[model samples]
Target: MLYAILAYHVEDEILSWSPEQDAAVVAKVIEVQAPMRASGLLGPAARLDETRKARTLRGPGAGMVLDGPFSETKEQLLGFHLVDCATDDEAVAAARKLRAVNPSAVYEIRPVKLYVPADGFGTTRG
Candidate 1:
């Protein structure tokens, strides 16, 4: 199964870190991800920019385009990791490893739901 591990942290607190501090934290993240990558369980992952650079759109159709993130929370989604795990336990274990490196951050793991085509046609199976 495919799982998405969402990383959340206080944007202000992170931005306040010195360059050296930031680099050290990122280095630890890389170290934790290395084994997962070698195991072929890691997929696409990336760190997002601050909410100030984000744009939110809501309402009907294209809706109204707004500045910043949709939510007004101190904690923001900082990044995500896509992993292929055999069970929920395995996915949780991956999240645990990440937490070990950065205890201040929060990780939310969710299973991915893949769409399957039916009868070799364009129809999709729910």
Candidate 2:
């Protein structure tokens, strides 16, 4: 099964990190992911840009365009990692490894139903 591990953090706190601090945190995360990556359990991962640059399209037919994210929570969705695992326990263990590196961030793990267009986008994961 494939899982999505969502990373959430306070936007303000993350934004406050200096370049060096950011690099150090990222390095730690990479270190934790090394084994998983080598084992082919880890797939794609990404860190999103600041929310201030985000645009939201909502309402009927998703026609309305709004500035910034629509979340009211203190923490924002900072990024995600796509991982392949045999069981829920395996996925949770992967999240635990990530949490050990960045204890301040929150991780939400969920199973994924993937789809890829047939017009050359790629193959589906079903």
Candidate 3:
């Protein structure tokens, strides 16, 4: 199964962490990724640009492409990791290792829902 490990910022994350501190965390991320890769668990990982670069589209017909940064929030998502694990224990272990690398960070580990192809009758079948 696939697990997504989400890391979001907390009160102290942006306020207290300096560039150097952030860099150290990034370095640890690198180390962790190496092990994850060796174990054949890591799928993809990325750090998003500030929310200022975001654009939201409500629907296809509106031609309404909203622009600009999202309203600021305290717990902005920082990044995530996608891991393929055989069991919950393995997924938790990976998340714990990441948490240990950066104690100040918070994470949410969740299972990825498997997608089923839609049946011809306009509905999805299991």
Candidate 4:
């Protein structure tokens, strides 16, 4: 089986929708994600808080993790989805559905590469 990673560099801030509209969007997501999860097609999906809630680590010798998000670009990785799919077309279709709800935001779809050793030791290469 092949899987795709749905990643994105989001704007520094996201616009807020009205309570009623937010409820409706949540309802729609529930309908879609439920079916995909039932079929084992939705491997994983998540939403992250703003960059302000982030912490960064430099290196093994960098000591304690640093506070605050990047002070750099307006783009920050906001969230992602790992999907089990049959082909790139199917992945793109899924991405399109997500984009429909977040038209103003950007979305990216890429293949996920997993390495499983012949001995089946269950170690990840990347």
Candidate 5:
């Protein structure tokens, strides 16, 4: 099974960190991800840029372009990790490892249904 691990954090709090502090936290996260990467259980993962740089569009047709994501939440979606796991428990375990490294952030684990052009747009069987 494939899982999507969504990372959420308070943008303001994260922005308040010094460069060194941010680097240290990122290093810890990388350390936790090392085993999964080596074992080919990890896939694409990324940390999103600040929401200030975001844009949004809603409604019909081309939609009404908006300035930012404007998400109505205290914590913003920060990043995500894709992983291949045998079961939901395995996926939760992976998220737990990440939480151990950065306890402040929240991780949401969800099963993924992947579709690709080469796969004729059919959902890939996990």
Candidate 6:
């Protein structure tokens, strides 16, 4: 099964980190991911740009373009990791590893409903 580990953190708290602190955190993240990557369980992962750079679009159809994220909250979606695991426990373990490195952040683990493309290229969730 595939799982999405969504990371949430306060933008201000992250921004307050010094350059060395940021580097240390990133190094720890890489260290924690090493085993998962070696096991071929880790997939796409990335840290999102600050929320200030985000643009939200709302309304009907394509929707009216907005200036920022759709919702306001103390914590923002900061990053995500896509992992393939054999069981829920395995996925949760991956989340735990991530949380250990980013102690101040929260992680939401969700099973993925993968989109498979057909001959015509339409998406079907599986």
State every prediction's TM-score relative to the real structure. 0.85, 0.86, 0.72, 0.66, 0.86, 0.86
Residue 111 of model 1, lDDT score: 97
Q: In candidate 1, what are the lDDT values of residues 1-126, reduced to their tens digit?
A: 999999999889999999999999999999999999999999777899887899888889879988968667668998999999999999999999999999989998999887242454533653
Model 3, 1-126: lDDT tens digits are 998888777645555779898899889988988988888889777776665567777767776778844647666667888889999889889988988888876788899896343356433553
Cand. 4 TM to true fold: 0.66
How much is the lDDT of residue 64 in candidate 3?
73
Ranking of all predicted structures according to lDDT, beginning with the best and ending with the worst: 5, 2, 1, 6, 3, 4
Clashing pairs in 6: none
Per-residue C-alpha lDDT of model 2 across residues 1-126, encoded as one tens digit per residue = 999999999989999999999999999999988899999988878899998888988889848898979788899999998899999999999999999989989999999998342463334652
By lDDT, the better pick of 4 and 5 is 5
Task: Answer with 4 or 6, whichever has the higher lDDT.
Answer: 6
- Model 1, C-alpha of 43: deviation from truth (Å): 0.4
Which residue runs does candidate 6 get wrong by more than 4 Å?
A: 115-126
Q: Which ten residues in a row have the lowest lDDT in candidate 3?
A: 115-124
TM-score of predicted model 6?
Answer: 0.86
Would you list the C-alpha lDDT of every candidate in the order shown?
A: 0.89, 0.90, 0.77, 0.66, 0.90, 0.89
lDDT of 4 by residue, 66-122 (tens): 886765755666777677788888988877776676565466777887834256343
Query: For residues 19-82, what per-residue lDDT tens digits would candidate 6 score against the true structure?
Result: 9999999999999999899999897778999998999878999898878885567999989999
In model 3, how large is the Cα lDDT of residue 31? 94
